[model samples]
Target: MADRWYPMGVPSFSRLAHEVPEPGMLVAHDRALYRVIVVHEDHPANWAEKDRNRLVQNRRAVEERKRHRARPLPREVFYPSPLDGWDGSEETWPNRPRGVELQPMAGGKRLHAGWPHPGWAYWYPVDEHHPVCASCGEPFPCREVDAAKEAARQMVKVEKLMAVGPSCCWHCGEPITSRQGARTFPGENLLLPGGPSPSFHQRKTGGCLYAAKEYEKKWREANPDLAETADLFGPADA
Candidate 1:
């Protein structure tokens, strides 16, 4: 009874009112509400044919749907792994070994399974949506991800990770560890003279070493009173 449904197809108000004679079955016709109504007779200006032919079949479908158990759907994981590229596929992970079959996600890009991705992984209808970067947490066409990629490339160029160790400057012969070490001298000279450099100092007293050494050299030449044996790293009074 409660689960029962009315007829399908177009509703004939006249036929229904005549057969059932329900109290609230009255329908408006020509500005006057009547128990029975006619179809296509008034030529109502607002009502469309599709809407006018109203039908509600199998109200049981709603009740059945409420009681019906749903089929188990596959689990969806968002945000593909950042290390998928670096770590090889041989290593088993959650939902890995047997990778969850992806059906062309929201954007063209799906979850990053691993290196050597199949054609199907990238298969998706063309759309305006762009893929999101896992590391930066920004969508594609993101300037931050672009900058990060560039920084990685620069790091490779500066460090030469595959090489033995930190590279020494070809001209200066000094160990170049960081990117800043590659800078040239004040004179724009790539190489410093093998003899002496200003940055290095010889003295250990109150005055700066380079300055003290320069002063000592100048004082020795000018005063000529102090012996050349005054010493470089000894007490200032000496």
Candidate 2:
């Protein structure tokens, strides 16, 4: 005989949502962009309870994302990170390990991924009032006129100093002395003779400012057997 027992409580399909993995999807909720790591798919009837319950579900992800401005992605991961072009409002799919790709559904022009925040460890904040835009000569904090100020930064010879600051090195947290002006000439090359390549943010900024070449020459004089690692980004354990 076939069973005839009816389920007492009906299930609601609308309540179900995709279950994402670690370092979950970056998305906007409550009119703010954030990384959402979990979802509580209880019945629509139970939304009032679940809405609050979701706070517990997403507490860690919210905390991790709030650490945003303070914790910048390193140059290594930054280079190939699919998150490179990611703006916060759209979805950033976490397909790659420790990284994300901008969601295709959000088909508008992207904003600069919030420049990595310089936490206490690496960068000291730079401040300039009425700083001229390196590109258009407009005043900076120029969100309305031209966004993605990458060009402006480069025009100012921010070169690597653009990584995280007013005018300083990200590696050592020191200011870039002898800037000579508010901006350096475009195409200027400020690099130490024998340090990490300009491909490295440290090499371009502190490598030149800190007299690393002199120190390197002396260090090489002292010891000459340590081989430079091919991958400055670090070893690939996986």
Candidate closest to the true structure, highest lDDT: 2
For residue 50, model 1's alpha carbon misses the true position, in angstroms, by 56
Task: Give candidates' CA RMSD values in order.
Answer: 32.0, 22.1
Provide the global lDDT of candidate 2 against the true structure.
Answer: 0.33
lDDT of each: 0.31, 0.33
Which model scores highest in TM-score? 2
TM-score of 2: 0.17
What would the per-residue lDDT of candidate 1 be over residues 82-175, giving only the tens digit for each residue?
Answer: 2222222223211121222222322343232221223222222222333444665333424454456568876765453223223443333335
State in Å the error of residue 113, model 1: 40
lDDT of 2 by residue, 148-197 (tens): 44456455545444454445443453555663211121121333333232
Native-structure RMSD, model 1 = 32.0
Model 2 collision count: 0
Off by over 4 Å in 2: 1-38, 41-104, 107-148, 158-238
